[model samples]
Target: MKKKKMDDQHFDKTIKGRLENFEGPDFDPTALADLRYRLASITTAPWYARYRTELIVISALLFFTLFNVLWQSQVEVNREQSFIQVMDSLKTSQRIIIDLQQRLSALRRITSDSSNASSKPMTPMAEGKLNEVDNLLSQLLEEKGNNDPSVIALLGQVSEFLRSEPGMNGDQSPPATPLSLLPSATYHFPLPASSDSARISLDQVTLKENGGTAEAKEKHLTAAMARELKKHFQKGVGIRLGPAASLSAITYSPGPRVPSVGGGLMSDWILSPSLSMETGIIYAPRFYDREGSTMMELQNLPGVDESLGSLKEVDITSQVVQFPLNLKLYVPLSRRTEGVLGGGYSFLLYLRQDLEYGYQFNDDFDGRFQGLKSTYEQAKPRFYPGTLNLSAGTSTLLKNDARLEFSLYYQYGLGDSGLEQVKANSFGLRTAYWFTIR
Candidate 1:
């Protein structure tokens, strides 16, 4: 035990001497400070350098999307404003034309009353005033052209008056030509004279049928002449036939965007000097070629995977019939050409549709499949009932009473049409040839 104690004491001294000779690693605050500085520098680096490529691409995409949206919005707003301005201008022009027409009618009534009066012959002063008025009218006709209905009517009345004047026939003797032989150019003639002076004037005029008094006979002759003149003007009706091409789209909704081409027949009638009516029938057919890759899954087959799919191609065709009734305003642009503005209602008579789908299989189990096809037909009150249309065009009168007309028209469907919730909005070009009926 005493020797073990001496050895343990010697080992303890040896371990203590070794611990005194051994030097541990020196602690430095600067090392910890250097590490913290490096970490902070990395965090404080420029944002662009940290996320350069990703940020650039995201910013570019966002800018492009924003620019596109703003440009499209600006274009739509400008278009709407322009359309409104045009409609307002049209309304104003129409009002001015109507006012001018009323003024012309009043002037014609005054002149007719003076001419039909059975007073003493026109004095030299009065005749000179009439001559000045006539000269002024001729100058206006030369400047404004013969297309003005008011001018034409006034000229016709002047010519009729010259023929009817008692002593203007270059013969002292009573005129041999009857009043019926003169063309009636006025729309409304002076009523038969009620006073004694009017009766005496009527007595001076002779008619073929003398059964009634001079006044009655004169009235009958005037009536016949008016009817004949009306018939002559009404004969200017025209029949038009043409081909039309249209590009149709849906607005305020989603639909198939397609163009339709067709032909039509129409009849135009002159209701008045400046107003006309047209009725027509149009048949248009549209074709849609839509092809895309679609994955269609197959099921319910033994030894076949449920995940099997195929690609498909879709195609559709449709047809529509339209009937239009329109009123056109004629604004003479020249002797042979006129500008036309019109609006009307259109009836969608019928619609026929066809769809075809073809499938190409990707899996060997199914291979290629046969196509599927379908057809449908719809008529008025079931699909589209009617639409409103606006048109602007020009017509040029050609030789032999034929006319060439070219127009651009826009149509807006009043309600939904077809099997889907779709309405037709279209703009079209129409060219027509019309032959006047004699």
Candidate 2:
């Protein structure tokens, strides 16, 4: 505000300075005679002279108030922008911390091998295995670039842990169970030692669609054969899902739109900001004349609402419930920010997908029509149980660490007709708040 005031004052001075700098012609024309006549005629008004000072004071006060209000608005706008920027940075920092934590956890989870020890009185092979272990230790304690002393120190601790773990020929007992669930990361030796051998394998999924055009000779799936061969070696494995998921949420595709006027109209009416309520059923049976169901949604029927106007019935209402399988990726954008993009497909319903199932259909009588006549057939929930996103957000803190965000996204239904695809744009806001990440 202080800077704004100073700027305004400087701008006013600059404007007046330019006006004062003008030098007029050194000739007096007939303009002075006309001015004299105008001055002689202006003395008739009396209210102007009495209220002149009061009007000047009032005008100055109004200007000051307007100037202050505008300045405050600008400040708020700047704060919001800065918050958004800081959010990106915070997201990036969060990603780095996560990567570091994962690395630390992997080091902690590593198991030792007692069978690899030299059984034959420390032969050349045993020496080679020891050399390999030494190399691994060097890698574990190596400095991370030039900075990040904590990460380097953590690596050193991991090296000490590895050294403490049992070696070959020591006859130490092995872990009761092996790590069979998580994917094991491998480190390259570059040049393998004389006695020790290393092998790697994938444990998760076998791909069916992962084929390059070049791999497919004359439209034949050559990559399929390659995958089949690779399965024996297990270079890349399929992923496994746990009985309990790590994260889950609800999201939808782009749905129908409501046009508004005068004030907040269509969006407020159809796409409810509040939880939707169903009155028996709100669809007409004939609307489903195309496919899938027999009975329609009933609204304002014999035992329904007193009003039969906008309240109508559908032919039938059918909902397809499904739990989604998601493939998620966290992309680091900068120092403290990250971009989240994930996609998946599933027709299996989980208990958590209740709201997602409800989201496929909606009906509002009082919410849509008020004083005007309009068409209602176009807004019915006809198709559902398609693909949808559970959560998608971009969290970032460009360089700063202060930003918060809120968003609203939804779709009325996923229609099957050709024309319905064009209506797939819905409401969502990308917002941000400000804060620092620890």
Error of 1 at 138 (Å): 24
Worst 10 residues of 1 by lDDT: 191-200
Q: Backbone clash tally for model 2?
A: 55
Off by over 4 Å in 1: 1-253, 289-313, 359-383
Please give, for residues 1-438, the per-residue lDDT of candidate 1 as tens digits.
Answer: 999999999999999999999999899999999999998888556868733533554465446445544544454333224434533442333222222333334334434545444445445544543455565565555644576554566577667756765433322222122223333221222212212111122232332323311122222223233223333334345344323334444342343467665555567877753578988776665454434532222112112232323324444455566888999997766656778899999988545554444444444557655443333333323336678989999988664345788888888878865544356677778776664442
Off by over 4 Å in 2: 1-54, 64-79, 112-438
For model 2, how does the per-residue alpha-carbon lDDT over 1-438 read when each residue is reduced to its tens digit? 999999999999998998899887876667788889899888676877734543554455446445544544454334335434543432333233333333334333432444553433434543443454454434433422323443344456546655765433343433332223324442221111212222212111121212210011122223332222223333232221111101112221222123211000001011111111111111111112111231123222222222334333222212222334444444444434445444444332211110100011223744544322222223222343444434455545332223332333232224332121222222343232322211
Candidate RMSDs in order = 23.4, 29.1
Best model number under lDDT: 1
